[model samples]
Target: MYSRSFNIKKDLAMRNEFAKKALDANPSHPQTNYDYGLALCNEKKFDEALIYINKAIDMDPANKDRFEGFLPLLFMAMRDTENSLKWLLKMSERDSHSRYLGWLSCVYAHIDDLDKASDYLKRFLDERPEIKTLSDYRKVAPAIAKNL
Candidate 1:
């Protein structure tokens, strides 16, 4: 009997391998490429990671989620705040709550940009009210909290 496995680490590895095989079989599946990049980012291979992530975006630049959210979010995790901000700035004009604002808040705070950090944190709180009352930010940025 074959049972389904629900391990994220295993799934992530499977996704990476499946992505590689899928790309080899059909060189234009953007979703597979994007999944690969996400896995690579999760594995902490940011530099080599960008190659696959860029391929996905280049294939479909209209997919703002790739460029504006996932890719830049990974960059922010890698502490590439400059590039992170660049991509985040490209998304600033959009309506609705801000996703990158949280990254900005943390980076700006790290860099002594108190005014901007404070501003971003407020915006982040507005966008996610539940986050305001929480005693832990680590529910999201666990690696960062480990260092702090």
Candidate 2:
């Protein structure tokens, strides 16, 4: 576990440095902005991550789907449930995948919107019936399942 943690940190440091260089070379490039934003998120720099992620979304509106997931995650990391729910709802509108439904359930549960949470959770379960247990649900949304 210690070695795994150390390796993850080392890998993220390397990726962060590479992303920084890429962003410096092309500050307005959408892909560079997205990569740098993701690297910043891995570094736990949520504010900086959101800036670049939003920039990426603005520069490439047609590819907004690519950047949507990061926004909610950064907001969640910052404990800003309103923004998280905003982005997650946008993501859900864009994609009806079980993964997004699961995220919606988790975020709604975070904000104590149990009705929405349960609705999304039911949708998620309907789409992912292979998930057979509470432990399986925990794998998707640990904190939310704990509340349920």
Q: Return the top candidate by TM-score.
A: 2
Error at 74, model 2, angstroms: 2.0
RMSD of 1: 4.3
Over 88-127, each residue of candidate 2 has an lDDT whose tens digit, in order, gives 7888787777877887887888779999999998998899
Off by over 4 Å in 2: 1-10, 138-148
Best by lDDT: 2
lDDT of 1 by residue, 1-148 (tens): 0001212445656655665566677668676666666666646787777887788788888884745456556666677778877766665646344656776787788779899999999998888776754464557654523443
